[model samples]
Target: MRARLTLGFFTITLAAVALVSVAVLPGLQSRLIDAKLADLAELARQYAPELRKAVGTSLPQSELQDLVGRTADLTGSRVSVLLVVTSDGEITVEAGTDSATERDITLDFSVAIEAATSGRVSRGTEAGPNGQVGEVAVPFLFRNPESGRRRVGRVAVFSSPLRDVEASVAVVRDRTLVAGSAASLLALLAGFLVARRLTRRLEAVQAGAGRVAGGDFSARFPVDREDEIGELARTLDNMRRQLAELDSARKRFIATASHELRTPIFSLGGFLELLADEELDPQTRQEFLRHVRAQVDRLSRLAVDLLDLSKLEAGSLELRPESTDVAELARRVAHEFHPALAAHDSHLEVRVPEDVVEVDCDPERVAQVMRILIDNAITHTPSGTDMVVSASRRGDAVRFGVGDFGPGIRRAMLPHIFEPFITSDDAQGSGLGLAIAHELAERMAGELLVESQPGRTTFTLQLPARPTPPRPAAPPVVTEA
Candidate 1:
């Protein structure tokens, strides 16, 4: 990974540098050539007037050559004076300062010819004897004193070689290569280091996950970074904590369930062995049989609770919803608990509103949750403790609650009260009723809320209210007009 990432960065940087060179080098060369031409054209313009006056006077060829040489020295270019022969229409170079053979150079005298013909300055580039050359020509006009008429007699051409411009472009090309190479190297190093660090962090997370997968829940992911990786680490760490808690709960549940199941089976076995004694009296056999029946009942309830809990956990528990009066449902569920209330020597008061508290919910599931809450209250509280089942409507919701006037639940157990196999005290039942109730409430889009304090504990099921539909309007009577 590190090698690949480094190479990727280096390749991108190299390509960028190559692209910049490709785009900029040609323009740079063109501009340099243009600047050189402009300088040559300006020099030709400044020296043309002097050469024209000298020509009108018919100055000696040697002195004209000297003057041209001096101008060339100052401008760092070749200066020449060319005359147009009217009879043959031929151009002849009268004097020059450069050493190039005039015939070879004058073969392409387009700039000078254009200047002489147009009577204006012209500039262009052409191939010279030595190399490419830039030329600027200014027309030389001679004024006749007698008629006061001006005529173009000669053209002054300023020429310069393009080697300097080529040299500058070469230097820039070399420097760009050097800088691009250095940048590519730096990118490679940076990419390698970054990729290495990233992979190391990922590996640490992988190791932690592996440990968790192997059932070592104590391993933790690192969360010290302040980037995306850090956020991932934090999320994984939170998940690990949850899984660890669940694992602990699972172990406790297995141990408790095993013990609960074993006791009933053992009691039934002992009762059967006792009933097998031939000498045992009829009353003793009947008592043993009763004990066996009670154990059997305990076993049956645990089996049913376990099945419900498994279904809830698997998300296969379906609900059948309908618009039902919650007040009446609460009364019915409370009345069903009368047998247990009598056994516990406790009375349950039903406090429901006179008006219907209608809500959209599964009546059977709602009754089941109420039964769980009521049974939980009776089982946990002491004998003779009174209980209350209440139902009412508030705003857009209807609430059915079961509460008890007994010692309240412990503060520490409130958070896990709805967890499977969780009991507040050493109660003689599978502790899955609250878990099933909680799941049922959630499936019905309702909530099971609890509030407990000394001598008061309530578990309330709150479901959204179903509004009553409006009656149809009466048909309008139509009489013949």
Candidate 2:
């Protein structure tokens, strides 16, 4: 991962450099070429009139050759002079650079002669034996300016192609290479530093995780940074702490289970031993047996609740969802709780709509949730306290709730009431009961919502109503062709 990240950074940096260099270097070279061409053109314009005068009116070929040679020497170029043909399709190369020159220099005398006669300037590039070359031609007319008719002699100024453009481009390429090398060195140093810092922090986290995995639950993470790595470190630390807490809970559960189980076992063993005795009071034996049975029942219930919680946590609990009348389900579960309510001197009052309020849910699980809620209500509310199981339709959902007029759950404990092994002062049962109920409700695509205050608390199970399918649209009629 680190290598890939470094490579990605380098790739982006290089790409940016290449893009900028591609756009800027060619443009700079082109401008330099134009500037050099302009300078050469200006030089030609400066020498045009002087060259025309030196090669004046029908000059001999020898004098023209001498003049061209002197001009080439002064301009530091292989120069050429051509005479324009009047009403003819040929140029007379009167004098210029050596014709047998091995440098393969051929001046474009035709274009130059044409420009001179037509009174215009033109420029072009051409190939010679040596290589590519540039030429500029200016037209010269020695006509009588006052006469409407014309008769003329022509001379053109010429030089070799400019070399400054190539030189400038070479300099630019060297500079770019130097700059790119320096940037790459700097990027390498920066990437190394960043990667080192990140790896160090991650190593620390990995070491902490190793300690936790090896059963050292006391490992904690550094809380120095506020970035994502820091958040990960903090989460790891939290997991360690939770594991420590769970370890302590496991020890407590073991001790509690042993004690609870041992008491019942001792009672049953003692009662059976007494019953086996040949001499014992009948009434005393019956009392001991009854107490043993009650303890056994309590232990059995505790074991059953623990098993149910395990099923819920492992996601192995199955739910069969179907449409059921909410009011009737609530009534049946409430009736089952009559004995427990009477024991607590509490009365169960049901407030369900007479109209069929159907809801999509697993009827058995819904009934179990209702039973748990009613049992919790009966246990928490003191004698003469009133409890109600009600059902109502709210929008597209049906809500079945159990409410009690008792000292409601404490505000602080409300959040975790549905969590496994969580219980409140006002409610005491197998703490798994409400947790299981909540899990069941959720498994049926429903939610268990709670509301509590000083004198009243309500637990509502909300489930979605069976959907009504939309009617099909009619097909449009087609016209005959």
Candidate 3:
């Protein structure tokens, strides 16, 4: 991955440089040639008059060559004066600096001819001895007595080689290549460093996840960075912490469940062995049989509780929602516990409003939660301790509460009271009831809360209240015929 990233960076840099070079190099050369041509044209215009006067008179060839050479030195170019022969309609080079070189030069005089014919300055390029040459021509004008107008008499041609512009462009091209290579190298180094750092952080997170998957929750994710990687690290670390807690809870649950199951199975085994004694008295055999039956019942209830809790945690338990009058539901559930209440020597008072407390909920699940709360209160409280089962509507929620006037729960135990297999004072019931109830409440989009003190302990289930739909108006009664 690191190598791929570095190559990616180098590839992008090279692509950019290639694009810029293709776009700029040609234009740069063309612009430089144009600038050189313009400068030659301006210089020709400045020296045209002097060259025309010299050509108009009968000056010696050496004197004319000297004058041309002086102008060439001043302008940093080759200077030539061409005579326009109107009679023959032709142009001939009258004088020039570097006579021998100019005679054999390859420069085409098209610009000088065009300037003489048009009576204006002209500029162009052509093949020369060394390389491409830019030339500019300025026409010399004189009054024509016969035509009553000015006419070109002579032309001054100025030219310069384009080798300097080519050299400059070549230098720029070479520099661009060097700079692009340097930039590409830097990009590769930077990419490798960044990818290395990123890979290390990701590997650490992967290692931590692997440890957690292997049931070793001691490994922790790193969170030292302040980038996206850091945020990822922090999130993974938080997951690690949560997984660790869940693992600890899972181990504790397995231990408690095994112990709870073993006790009843051992008791049932001993009782069954005792009952098998044929010489035993009838009363003793009956007592053993009773003990076996009780243990069987306990085991059955425990299995059911475990199943319900597992289904709730696995999100497999479906809820059937309907509009229910919790006030009526409360009375029904409390009435079912009459036998238990009587057995415990306790009275369960139902406090429900005359008005219906309507809610959209699964009535069976809500009833199950109520049973758990009421049973918990009865089994934990002292004998003859009174309890209250109440249902009421508060704003947009309906609450069902069960309170017992008995010794309250320990403060330290309240936090984990809703956890699986939690019991207060080693009570004689499977401790999965409150955990199942809490899970059910949450599944129904509600909350289960507990408040306990010395005199009273209350468990409240708060569920969202569904507003009752209004009834339709009745049609008017039919009139008598």
lDDT of candidate 3 vs native?
Answer: 0.86
Candidate 3 colliding pairs: none
lDDT score at residue 223, model 2, on the 0-100 scale: 67
Evaluate all candidate structures by whole-model CA lDDT and list the values in order.
0.83, 0.72, 0.86
Error of 2 at 138 (Å): 4.1
lDDT of 2 by residue, 1-481 (tens): 5665566667767776797689988898778756655665776787656776765567777776777677667666555655555557554444442322545544455556656556677655555555435566666566566886554455464656545565677788787878877777777667777777888899899999999999888888896799999999989999999998888767765665566567678878877888788677888878877887887787797788777777887899887878898877877787777677767777677777666767778899889888888877777777788887887776788888888999899899998888765678634355768888888888778899999998999999988887544334333222110
lDDT, candidate 2, at 181 = 70
- Candidate 2, superposed: residue stretches over 4 Å from native: 1-27, 45-56, 60-78, 82-134, 138-157, 160-163, 209-278, 425-428, 466-481
**Least well predicted 10-residue stretch by lDDT in candidate 3:** 472-481
lDDT of 2: 0.72
TM-score of 2: 0.74
**TM-score rank order:** 1, 3, 2
Q: Candidate 1, residues 6-25: lDDT per residue as tens digits?
A: 88988999999999799999
Better of 1 and 3 by lDDT: 3
